[model samples]
Target chain A: MFAGAAAALLVALVLALARAVLGPTVFDRVQAANTVGTLAMLLLAVIGFLTGRPDFLDLALVYGLLNVLGTFAVLKFFRYGDLGDPGEDEEHHT
Target chain B: MNTVVDILSWGFLLAGGAFCAIGALGLVRMPDFYTRMHAAGVTDTLGAGLMLFGMMLQAGLSLVTVKLIMIGLLIFFTSPSATHALARAARARGLQPLLATGKGPSKRS
Candidate 1:
């Protein structure tokens, strides 16, 4: 069962990668990249279970945190052209 | 009891995998960036949630299960934030969402 899940996730990851590569817009690629990160995290967890190595779960957790941080960093850079900027324009919308 | 657990795990894993695959398909097939974000959201939420839940069940009351829950929580909290940031950035940059007419792109002034 874990094997099946892993295989499906692999296929999904490839599809997401394809979308990222074929993007007509920057947002599309970022979205796809985020999806890819999510799938990778899932894959890591499933593989840990399959291998009976529970320690892999730690790695998955770290990866998930990194994924979010990376996305935010990239979006910040894209929006304000600098990660340090407060994204003031972004705040006005919300 | 063991058999029951096995069955439950299998069911969750399969369902999660199916959702993940379907979401990825949507990502490829969706007409616009906003729609594609919706697709990826599906995989990020339901797909990852179910899969991690199954792993938690398999791990039972152990540190592994604790770690799995932590990972799930992380994804739950961050996925939406990231998606929101992406959408907000796109909108702020003047990238308009596709309209319902499905005819052509429209920008908001």
Candidate 2:
């Protein structure tokens, strides 16, 4: 059962990768990348259960946290052109 | 009792996998970035929730189950915030969502 779930997640991961590759815009790639992170995290947890190693769940939790942070960081950079910006009104240029 | 638990766990795992796959398909087939985000939302919430619930059942009342719940909570809190930020940033940068009427690029000249 765990193997089945992992297989499905792998399929999803591949599809998301396709979207990331075929992006018409940078945001599309970012969105796809985020989805990929999510699928990978789920995959990690499922694999942990399948292997009877619950420690992988901890890894999945860490991965989930990092994925969100990474997405936010990338989006901030895309929006402000810098990682640390307290200024409220930076120029809005795509 | 053990058989019952096994059956329930299998059901949850399979359903979660199916939802995840469908959402990924939508992500690939959606017309634009905003639409793709919506598809991704389905996977983030439903797919991950069901999978973790299934695993929790398998783990029973233990620390593993607790960790699974923690992971689920993290996903629930962070996913929407990240999606919102991505959409907001895109909009702020003049990235107009695609309209259904087939109108040409909806950006200011």
Candidate 3:
């Protein structure tokens, strides 16, 4: 049953991959990348169970954090065309 | 027993898969960036949440299950933030929202 679901989501991931390839805009591609990140985390968890090694949850956690940070970084770069906004960020946040 | 749990997990998993597919179709079908942002928010929030919930049931309510719930919460929080940021950036870039006929922003350029 779990394998069936994992397969279904894998199909979804593949479809998203097609969209990413055909995306006409940068934002569409960015959204595709985000979907890929979320799906990767879910896939990791399922694979962990399939292998009977629950310790893989730890890897999922690390990957989830990385996915969030990586998405933020990519969006930031696309938005500002820079890794950091030295003036506006420091002033606005602090 | 595992049968009941399996039923529940499969249902949730199937629902999650449907939501993800719908979101992808939305990506292909939606008119522009802002509308796509609307679709993206729906996809990540519900789709990821359901898939994580299904996995948690299979995990049988343990520490890992708690972690799974936490991850869902994180996605719930961050997905919107990410979508909002994308929309704001799109607007900043002068990307226009798709509105129904005669429903666009009234203030003319």
Q: What is the lDDT of residue A24 in candidate 3?
A: 74
> Order the candidates by DockQ, highest first — what do you get?
1, 2, 3
For residue A43, model 2's alpha carbon misses the true position, in angstroms, by 0.7
Native contacts conserved, per model: 0.90, 0.84, 0.41
**DockQ, structure candidate 1:** 0.85
- lDDT against the true structure, per candidate, is 0.89, 0.90, 0.75
**Which wins on lDDT, candidate 2 or candidate 3?**
2
Pairs clashing in candidate 2?
Answer: none
**Candidate that scores best on lDDT:** 2
iRMS of candidate 2, Å: 0.6
lDDT of 3 by residue, B53-109 (tens): 888888886988987887787777877777777677777777777666666654422
All candidates: DockQ: 0.85, 0.78, 0.56
Positional deviation of residue B77's Cα in model 2 after best superposition, in angstroms = 0.1
lDDT of 1: 0.89
For model 1, the docking class works out as high
TM-score of 2: 0.91
The window of 10 residues in a row where model 3 chain A has the poorest summed lDDT is: A85-94
Compute the DockQ of candidate 3: 0.56
Please give, for every candidate in the order listed, the TM-score of chain B alone compared with the true chain B. 0.90, 0.90, 0.86
